[model samples]
Target: MTTQTYTPNEEKRVYAGTTMLMIGSCIGASLLALGNRFSNLGWPLSTVYMTLAVIFSFWGYRQIIDACTYTRYSTIRSLLIVTWNKVIAEIVGYATMFLIFGFLVAYCVISSDYIHSIYNFFSKTPACNQPAAYDEGLCNEYIKCVAASNKVDKIIRAIVGGGAFMLLSFVSSVGILSLISSLSLILVVFSISVILGRCIEALIKGKLAHDSGGWTRREPPIPYKPDVWSVLIDFPSYFSLYTLIPTIPSLYAEMKGSISEKTKIIHRTSIYATVVLITIYMLLAYVTSATFYGSNQENYRQDNILNNFSDNDKLVLSVRILYVLVIFTAFVCCLFPCRAILLDIVKADRTTKRGKVLFFVTGIIIVLLLTILAIFVPSITLVFDIITSLFGFVLYLGLPILVGLKIPVLKARREYMEATRAAMHRKDPDTEMKQTNAMEAKIRDRTNSITAFLSVFGPGATERVRQASESIVRRMSMTSDRLSIGGRADRASSSSGRRLSSYRHSHIPFKGVPSTIPEASDLSKIETPPLNNVSLESEHARQQSRLQTIPETYEHDRNRVQEVTEPDTEEEETTHNISTRVVTEQVAIDHSHTISDEVLLEGFTPPKVSLKRQIILWTITSLFIITNSTSFVMTIIKIFSPKGNTGVCPK
Candidate 1:
């Protein structure tokens, strides 16, 4: 059978594309519920929460940037595998998968529900015809009108949810996420402009600030007295606001540029997106709350703020349409990262037919599951609450910081190895040997330090540290001995059948002399003046005898060289440090084959970092993990508490 050739899946992504992806995913269906929730917090408090959330989000986003810079891993699973062990990585990886799935289901549910709401709002005629009658009787009748279409609404939701995912699958297969993101960005800007325009119009018409005060008589910028309840209610919304942070690594990986350039792109795009999102959310929340700020304002609260506005208003109707487009585009944008992570987990080559089949199979199953969930579980509040509180904490807040701590430790080791290796390339064998001895001492000290620091993590950590240290030490010792200048000189002498240097061969006594010989290591302690004081005839006789023994010594070296040239057993290589041994053997081969010095120094293993640096990194890592874990537990407890806020705005 003939084999089919497939094209590579490489696609170019630009700065605008990256920016649009961030904004598109950030402004998902969750924003529909934001106005109501922010209204509950009022102007000052919500502004504070959003500000703090942005700061933390940016901090976490920076960690991912740094991680991608060093590791160049495209997916979260890949980064996790390097920063932690495979077992922990897989555990966290699967959890992140579920998190993304939850988000996918949430987007579907919110989008479908909002579409139904929009339809219900416009399709039915109001019971009260007059403007004054709207508040007196029509408002209540509107709820009844909406409920009357429940059966039709469910059918509409199912069709929309399923059709949207089907469209996403088709679009993804065709590789149009870039096109989708661009469109989503346009929708995002238009939607924001429309909301702000309406807000500005309300302000111009003097419909916002009441005679009671700017925000109401008692609380100027807040509706209710700021309490513990408000904080808990707003916390999850804060996490939801910056939900795009977790997907940044995948996006960073896809961008076509050097690591530095990608970092710059991410930084610039993130700043712009943050400014736009924050300005819009804060301004919209302030204006929305200002319009209806009072004890009676709670009466107007909606899961979707559009419900509070007049259905007949052209601006509001257009906003609904804009949101519908935004939701679908955003849905497609979110799917790309999910696909990337899933493919990474399965270790599938996307260019192959089997891999493509697996991807479609997985995608269909996920979409079908999400569609069923959207049809049945219609509450967006419940979905966002659980997701932002739990997965949000782990993925966005916890993992990034955890990875950041290990980065510096690895970086220090790398820099140290490079500097030491460069220092060892000196022309003077004595100087190079001296530096090599110093490096050994330093390595031992660092190993001890690393072991002590790791011991704090408990015995499992300590044992791993010990093994790594022993393996690294053994490999370094072999490498240093084999690759050092003195070692190179010795190898050259043996291979060329030349007499050894005096400093190395002084331990061998002259064949005719009966005097004691100095050890090579103790050559410095021997008195050279005694040799000078001997007679010229005796010296000539000693030199002639030493030359006579050269053939035997060369023959012995030939045999030794033959033995050293033999290939090592695979099992023996495996027993040592694999990476170190491979690199060392490569260098040995390079030397034997007369490869350049630069090529020989290329694959040296990084030495352990100083103990102080390890302490600092581990300390910071523990701090971040502890803080995130504690906050996560507390949030979870509050979420499940009997009296906890369901993140629903008060009616």
Candidate 2:
């Protein structure tokens, strides 16, 4: 048997790849779906939502950084270990992984639909011309019948749709999706070119119309209809809303960079790249919307504005290419995170080979299921909303905040104690203890400063401080025994224990020692004793014995201290102080640099402004959600409602 150690090539160019992955991952079927979503919010609200998305991007970046720095565990597993109890962490991790898999399944269905749409569009000419193979009258009648009654064809469509999704899933399992993704990128570039060309033409025409007195300002399109605003607002909202899933993988990769500085650079670059991509997307969307709305067509019927233009314009071949490219990229980018979460859940029990195999098998199953569902329930909007709103909220917003709260509790406890001591000593008037008091105050101050820094930056900053302090202790231990005792105790207490039982239980081979503490005997032995041959008095004594000692046990006391003070060496203290000052001074030098270097490195950045951005973003996103969901719900309601529209358009 041979052991293989995998090391990432340090010299690889990550910026371009990362940027593309981020863009591709973020923009998905949602871009087209959002056109309809934003239509409900109207143009003004939609613009506000787009701006809010930019703000949320920064906020999301900050939260990721906070989680990374505070958790000090590069892997999601490690962070979970520290933030959650072992059992909870495992459960949450598995749940998150399952959610990601669900998302991947949904993506596969969408990808198939996109491909199918393109295929049907191109094949139309031949199909229409071949009257022998294709009965135009029969097809027209079939479509009209479907349009007249949605119920008759729905069951059959569902089965076909599910089968198509399953096929894509099977293809993905066989690694065919990767090839598709690579080819899709080229198409994506072409599509962007087409969109840009159309946008330029529209803008030019609009300006020309204004100058020639051919343009008249008409009332805003469908002022009261929420669907109009939903389309406009949600379209741009895709920049942030869609980016969350893809960012997970990119952030994971960024953390794997060889140098910390490289990681920081990658993080910063991702933020700027995202902003730039969103700006381009927004511009394209605005132009498309404006052009379609400016025309005399019924506003609601102007679905897929970009595609509508591409169909008539020969020059928009490039734009169609870009759309395909985007679809491919989004699919690929999403796979990384989806696979990562899957690996996280299964890696403990399975080998890498087995894991990969399992991933493929599972993905295939999901693809099939989703495809069938899509076929029968061909509502992309409904599927996108359910997946995005439910899982996106959990992964992006809820999880990070929960993790952040856990890591800081210990440091916060230390700060509170030190503050209490400082207050107590301030009132003490004993002159003989002044020097001792001064030293205590100094220690408290240092701890306070470090804790404050950790609170703001996250656990990673604290770990760095601790490491620097340890190095200093190692160097100084040669000359001073006083420092050595403290350093050894710190290492013994901090290194051998502190993590929850579930985390330490699997790793440590020893059996007799407690799961949390190597020194203490197994707690289970004392907690649950043998039942045979025990007198009532003896049993009572034993029960009382267990009850009396449990609270005073070494493990319990150690845990208490662990919860208060993080172990630090004298050398580490000095190093921490110096590094803290350096980082602070660097921040003072340049704000953006601080943002890029420190904040972005963690995969999050704070909002440039205050809660205002969050408020606005949340409001618009909520509105978009409401309008889209309402429309979907209404469609369903209409289906069940008496004498309401239930007919589906002919295929």
Candidate 3:
């Protein structure tokens, strides 16, 4: 029997590819809905809030990238696993799941309108009787000739949107999606440019200002007092505006080149995405506010910016087409992170036929649920608020900040370990000990400060504060003994690998054991050939000096050296591939390993669930339950909870 040799899947995504992936995925469709939501804060104040979010969001994104590099964690859950525990990781997973579900619900409702408009734009159905009489805006010129659109329009649109969703589901292949996403971004930018130009033209022609009093340019920007509670709720508004921050882990994973190169990619991604998003957000907000101002204008309020425009007007309809184009592509791109993470959790790899089935089914199920939501409870801003303010806080703001605080201690410990290991492996230990002490002392002082800061839970400790503190304390303290750094190239290559950069040792098995591999799909477990060639001299050289910058793993067992030559087989893979595989796999590990299933299955400890984690898990789970409960209750109450403005129903 001949065992078939298959080529491994390795995608070489460039920097531009990174930018396109982020822009397409992060730019949310709900952005078009943000105008009316923030009308209270006025355009200037709202712009300030959004622009600041963009800047802070950029800082947050970079910090997340740094946290990953410093810790060498490829996936978000891996970082969570290493830094905290499985419980914390699981909590984050739950958050992602809930957020995605909520987004689907919200997207279904929002996308329905775009779908309806798109259908109305092209077809002359009974709903749109006067196909040729469209120059009239929704304000009446064109609407009089058209039949009144109702829930039927939304249902029909949902069906069509579902078709588009299904089509993108299958074609959302890794490489192909990159090109698709880039194309989508182009469409969005072009479309936004047209609308932006219209906004500017209206403002210049004094068409937007209905009266001299409506133009408040010479007057101070609208007076606004933002409360803490209101601000948190309003984050969903911004969340809908900027959805890219949630996908940072996947972005980090796809980055090409060295660690620095990847960081540069993230840096550029943040700048480019932020600048573009903030610019458009400001302009859109300005148009919405300037177009509809004061308490009287609130009476004519619509759910989104499109509702403010005449659906029958040729110019507005053209812009609506652009929005539909963006929403179609953006919605597909948004599913990637959610789908990828869910697949990993379920132990389904997308590399196989069965895995592809699992992938497609997952997408279909998600869209199906969203379609139901659109038909039943058509929510928009409230859903966005809940999604962003709650889970968004955890994934976007909390983890990054926690990681930022934790990085210094981790860096210190790493430095200390490297210094100590170098001294031990040096030709003249006596001479190196003198070199190590000074650096070690500095690191020790830093670690002491950090550990102290971590230990104290002084006051005003809410669930988030408690969760973050406990998580940081647990991960740092649990790894305190093993904080001995000098990762892959630094540790003694023990037979069991318990001490080999802690968990990273799982990448290598018994050093010189010869073996035949089935496949590289499970990178964590399987070892490569020529495992015994590492000499103590080479190991010591690496330990005492700076390691090579190549992507391959540089293993060094300073305490022991075993050299055994191997006879070549009929078909042998390249040394570079085998070696590179070792290091690369280390960078991209998950919960379990293929070869070490017995030990890997027992990898993470059971729920010694810390107070912070418990709180987080509880809050997230509760938040999910409570929000759905509240929404349902509110839906029932909307039959009596003051008719027109509750935004739940009968609008």
- Give lDDT tens digits, candidate 1, residues 339-377: 766888788877899778877776777788888877776
Tens digit per residue, CA lDDT, model 2, 1-651: 433222345333555565666665555455654444444455666666667667656666555555554334455555566556677566656556555555554454444434433543464421111111246686576556435334423443444345443344334342556656655545655665665665566457553211221232223543324453244224322433535532443365445433344446456656866776677666656555554443232212224434344222445533554554554444445545555566565553235677758767665655555555655544555555444444444554445444544434533433454455554446555773695567445544443333332221222333444444555455555657555666655764463243323233333211222223232465333222111112322433443343334323433453354343433754344434434443343344334222322322343322233356456655755664564455445545544556532223223
Q: What is the C-alpha lDDT of each candidate?
A: 0.57, 0.46, 0.54
Q: Largest TM-score belongs to which candidate? A: 1
Report the lDDT tens digits of candidate 3 across residue range 1-651: 433222223222454566667777766656666665456555556666677567657666776777766666667788777666788787787788767777766665666776676666577433322222223353252244332566565666567447777677676555655555567667667656665665566557744322211232212234244433334345434644656655776677765556666666677767776776676776676666555533434323455665544444566676676666556666776677777777887899899988899898888887777776666554476666666656765666566555555555555544555555554445676776675566445433433322222111111113334454455456555776876433522333342233223333222222232232223365344332121222322432442232232222233342346465553631122233333443443344321222322332233333333467456545644553454445344434543455453211112
Global local distance difference test of model 3: 0.54
For model 3, the stretches where C-alpha displacement exceeds 4 angstroms are 1-25, 44-48, 51-59, 122-148, 167-174, 206-232, 239-276, 293-300, 340-360, 428-640, 645-651
In candidate 1 the C-alpha lDDT for residue 536 amounts to: 25
lDDT of 2: 0.46
Model 1 regions lying over 4 Å from their true place? 1-25, 72-74, 121-124, 127-143, 163-174, 204-221, 224-230, 243-273, 292-295, 336-358, 376-378, 420-651
| lDDT-based ranking | 1, 3, 2
Rank ordering of all candidates by TM-score, starting from the highest: 1, 3, 2
Q: What's the TM-score of every candidate structure?
A: 0.57, 0.50, 0.56
* Local error of candidate 1 at residue 637 (angstroms): 9.2
